[model samples]
Target chain A: MGRFHRHTDGTVHEHEHPDVRHDVGDHTGYRESGTVRVEVLENLLAENDRVAAANRLDLERAGVRCVNLMSSPGAGKTTLLRRTITALSGTLQLGVLEGDIATSLDADELASLGAPVSLVNTSAGFGGECHLDAVMVRSGLGRLALSDLDLLVVENVGNLVCPAEFDVGEDARAMVYAVTEGEEKPLKYPVMFRAADVIVVNKVDLLPHLDFRMDRFLGHLRDVNPHARVIHASARTGEGVDEWCAWLLHVHGTPTQRG
Target chain B: MCQAIVDTVTAHASGRQVRRVTVRIGHLRQVVPDSLSFAWEVLTEGTELAGSELVVEHVPAVVECAACGERTTLDWPVLVCAACGAVDVRLVSGEEFQIASMDVAEEVP
Candidate 1:
């Protein structure tokens, strides 16, 4: 017969073989055995989720609605952010947290527009993680004036795969998919598409130059994320910026009409 | 991600030599198992977990319709209900990322 012991630390040690020692040595009353089954049913991302939950509570307490924006590289996320900041500067107080593997070039650009921005260079720590987890977002939050801001936007490191897995405690998750990237992106990177609450099809101005089909793209997006609000935009010509800004205002529960 | 795994293994299986480690990953997690395995090999080169086998179990995503209560094991990216065609569906499983158990070679005293 095998012996089973429960430790105060919540670890269960089970000795399945007769040759295994119930009490060989050590203060824990369990010794080196033939094969010990240590049941550790713990999530690997539990720590991250805990930190994310705290971040959510912190943002909620400050009455700041946070949005996490994720997309592939060269998806016009920074351009969209710049336009949104310029459009909503007078209507709502906005702050941005920009995440990058290296360089604060995007942050500097946003700051030039007179927007409050914080830069999180992941290359500085965690070995340049491709995704911005909750801990990194919390570090960025420390540098921003949360009390003075009504909306906080976190532009996640430009990657479709890893960023979708980590939740940074944002009230809404949005993604930008430029039409130049092709219509097959929604299916190719389904996780990011599925996780998004809103998806913006940027670079509509280039639609005439490219073979991107609107119906096929929307069909793929709807198949993966039926509830995601899809907005067609052209950051270069300021097309769809009004509707996008209106959606943002609506999400923030503020009056959509400008004074 | 590799560093997190090393820390977790060191914390739980301290004294013993980890021969193999099993992890259960959900489909919705977007973790590439092959990439993870490669990362494990690179990260554990000089550590105690060197040469340890990394076993992975993938769990398929399951979504439950909020409107019709239809459950489905999703093969594709489509999250809508198969039974009711309802757009309002909640994921019930497939976000799991956990260290299920480890097979360690105990040091004979």
Candidate 2:
């Protein structure tokens, strides 16, 4: 018998067994058995998780806090980073691990900000991988001197899906959600929203011209992740960038117990 | 994810011919079964594990309510309790993503 749990009504709910197929095999009496069952119980993402844990340990040992920033394409992640870099200039030592599918476009933009920036391009893969996994971040760390930085912001590839699924050994996860992406985004992409520790609702400066409802969007976000710290900002207008920088300072100051 | 599975299967099989690969995937992982199967086929093609059956056992997301102490199997992605409607609920089991086992041909002496 597999694992069983009791409901509030006293009914025992037996966990579904994948081995049921063997008992319900074809009634036709035919047995060609030369195979043995090998128990290889392991998480499929163990490799990635292991690498992420190692990366976290290395970062922590070097006394650096890392944050993974994610968002959809054109959601102003780069712009927010630019604003944040400017706002936190000289206040804290910072470095950026800019991840992109191809090209050095975003890296070039951040390089001009006078901060150490390492670019990790995944264009070698088939059409380039959508997200930056732990291995990629580990490789990017090679070019960066972790001891010199107080915080490392990994600007993940512009992807809301796969980026949330992969842990890049960051102390926290922040995402940029633009108001132009529609109010139903939180409901549609619950996983990404739920994974974020901080969510920045960017492009609030365009609120007067767009038909986007902030209330509905926030309501959906609340439904998906009530605990996420949300900040309404406009990377273009330099609005709410201070609060974002404050949060970064907070993360940098706090001793992270995460691995 | 498929690539991960393939790498795991290859490492575990170790000179043996795999017949079936069984994996337990949680609903919260948001992996589509059909897409995983297709990816498995594509990834395993021309490899040692080619033609092996990939069995995906979906695990439903279940949360234990903190206030009411009721375990609710969630149909949706919302983390609220079904009985008490409380948002403070601890997830019991839904984030699982593992390779449970595999059926491999016995070694020829």
Candidate 3:
């Protein structure tokens, strides 16, 4: 059989293939003969995963359990981390890797908590990356002495989408979901909601002032992730901070990679 | 994701002009094919893959129900099993994001 030239309309013809490009067409089954198909068969996230595994091993060797905290903007991730730092101070050696797009405001707030904090401003050199990948976390990891800390909380950039896509060598992933964000978020952004090991429903104190329904939110969340542990909390009023802190303590003590 | 594809293709192509790069993206990955192709073009402009094509193979989200013993492919992002509508289903597939293969121009003797 001669080499076939495929068209954008899903038609193929046996003829001499031209150098005409089809960048704007739907790339369904376009194939040619002069080109040799090389089977790479590699996961695009393989590079990120390899770095994440190395970061995990490094943290494990240091006897530190890391948690990746993610959420949408204004979901109170920083507030919860601040409260958690205050609640767990002196009891647990806490270290924070604060991720933000352009500002040090979050890092500034965490610095007063008396724990070692490493701020990873994505805008500095990362071309304003929306989420912190393993490479970014590794760059931040160097600033913190892992051996000196019992827990490392990576405050992923406040993005429910891209943050969930990248793994930064964390033992567990916690998502701070505010009640005001709407019940349909789980269904709308299932990737982020499903990736969470624990979903902290923040701003529950304002539940009375809003039209948010806990039952509906839980129902939707269950549809996406039935196994994620849900915790009702308010970072502003310090409610449920103890429960959140206790969960962190428990996760820190547990060996994440025993199997 | 586009950046990852370019890097992978570049590494595998190894100085050869890339004719086409094939990638398999699961529905759960939430990648829009058009946006990916646009990004690919933007990233490949002026590079060896300038006029190269990006072939996208979309993988649907499939789940196996634990209670009903059924495997269903979902059209939406919801993870519920379509057979028995059970939420206690494990993901069978749909988290894939990989470069399957690439076509490079054959060397002329």
**CA RMSD of each candidate after superposition:** 3.8, 7.1, 6.7
Better of 1 and 2 by DockQ: 1
lDDT of 2 by residue, A181-242 (tens): 99998887889999999999999999999999998889889887989999999999999898
lDDT by residue (A82-191, candidate 1, tens digit) is 99999998999888999999998999999898889989999997579898999999999999888998999999999989999888999999999899898888888898
All DockQ scores: 0.58, 0.45, 0.53
Question: How many pairs of residues in model 3 come into backbone collision?
Answer: 0
Under CAPRI classification, how is model 1 graded? medium
What's the best-to-worst order under DockQ?
1, 3, 2
Q: What tens digits encode model 3's per-residue C-alpha lDDT throughout B45-108?
A: 9998999999999888899999999999998888888999888888888988998877776534
Ranking by lDDT: 3, 2, 1
Using TM-score as the measure, the top candidate is 1
Q: Pick the winner on lDDT between candidates 1 and 3.
A: 3
**RMSD over all Cα atoms, model 2:** 7.1
Superposed by TM-score, candidate 2 places the C-alpha of residue A178 at a distance from the truth, in angstroms, of 0.2
Give the number of the best model, judged by DockQ.
Answer: 1
